[model samples]
Target: MEVKRVRALAQRALIRRWAEDLGSPSAGLATVEAIRSHLSRWVERRHGTFSFRLTQVLTGHGCLGRYLHRIARREMTSSCHECGAPSDTALHTLIEFSAWGPQRHSLAAFVGGDLSLPSVINAMIDSERCWKEMVLFCENVMTQKEAAERERENSTADPLRRRGPGRRRLRYGHLLLPP
Candidate 1:
């Protein structure tokens, strides 16, 4: 009984720490709401194979212009590169981007018009083909977006300021070591 109590307490502490971390503004991930909504439980089986593209699409942390502009400061605006949507969020790219109209329409047709995240998730779980479709959609969209972003950066006034993946641009304040 004592061991069980201690284990339960430890689990509670871990969950509390995770919640606090997720709430932090500098958590580096912008999909807190999505993570909380879709992936909070540990026991649930994930439907699709994991990939970087899928992670980017689901977490809103990749080359999407909104993420680039707001979180990474890599873009001047959060507009979609193709359609110029005011904010190029993951959902916007997935569901509404005119550039991806054919793919989106195909996906929507497959899922019967319910393009919400929950519906997509359920579709993926319900069919392997749906999972593959989702993966393909993410790959197609993210690859094009990444290429466009690279081209934009290279054409910009200061391409040298662009940091590669896993590298953070250091500010003057970040140059100092903590005492």
Candidate 2:
């Protein structure tokens, strides 16, 4: 019941309509207020490494994706080159990447064994999981991502690869025509 109310309150406008939802600060507030309310009510604000990293996952802002594309137009492809997956969203990386199966499974079990993104977020502070474990998970995900980026950079930087046609592949995958 409370979970349903929390989800509903997170919707901004519906927050007020759910008059019985007066317990949560987001029950009848603006969108920004609702966000701030949730942060103020549920999340800790002080300096904590795990919470800082977790917030990036919660807000859908960390790692490679559309946001990374925006930040580094040339460095990142909108789609994942390694997996040939479309969008390559943060959610996809966290919940769908095949290579992350083991980490995901362990993290999912730690959270609630559901493996759903929403469940994972809701379980952020659940008694079943510890914050340090979540932090380690986030750290591992980031380490893997960083290593992939470095590998890609090293591959693209090598200049000795021979091309079949009269074209060349640059660091950003752009083709160079023969002189």
Candidate 3:
């Protein structure tokens, strides 16, 4: 079925479910109806027909009903590991992470620095410039993680690597003798 039709049907079903849960007018059916109408209007105002599914996936909501609840709560936050900054909000994390200054500089160098989050998101969704940069960023992070893991492994396996080869012996890369 078309997505809009599906969404409308889902909304209708949700309103019905809410109404059923209320059981009778004594249970405040009018309030439930008002809420449903408000939500439908909100969906229309925000162009939810085009983005409801994507927003659900990105925001960790698996269904339209859950996504609507999450949006209503405005629940978004993550703590920045680098600076202990609260990077919970979408805009803050995307545009204002303390560690993001350098990362954004790097990204801008590769993709144009002045780009905004919405533009970047659009680019990523459209498989444009920001998409390429996102891939590069992931690669760089993976490479750094791999390097750190190798260093950790090497350090644990051979402490002499932390010291000079003079303390041990030249294995493959360099030639150094103990002084």
Error of 2 at 136 (Å): 1.5
Q: How do the residues 54-106 of candidate 3 rate in per-residue lDDT, one tens digit apiece?
A: 33223333212222234433223333333455443333433555544665567
Return whichever of 2 and 3 wins on lDDT: 2
Q: Model 2: how far is 145 from its true place, Å?
A: 1.0
| Model 2 regions more than 4 Å off | 1-41, 44-48, 51-56, 157-179
Deviation from native of the Cα of residue 123 in model 3, angstroms: 2.6
- The per-model lDDT (C-alpha) reads 0.74, 0.56, 0.44
Worst 10 residues of 3 by lDDT: 60-69
lDDT of 1 by residue, 1-179 (tens): 99999987887677667777777645535456444444434214455686799888877889887888888887778887788789988889887877888888878877768877777876776677887888888888889888887787777787442865444534354776787
lDDT of 1 at 81: 76
How far residue 81's Cα lies from its native spot in candidate 2, in Å, is: 2.9
RMSD of 2: 12.5
Superposition error at 58 for model 2 (Å): 3.4
Off by over 4 Å in 1: 1-43, 159-161, 164-179
> Candidate 2 — worst ten consecutive residues by lDDT sum?
159-168
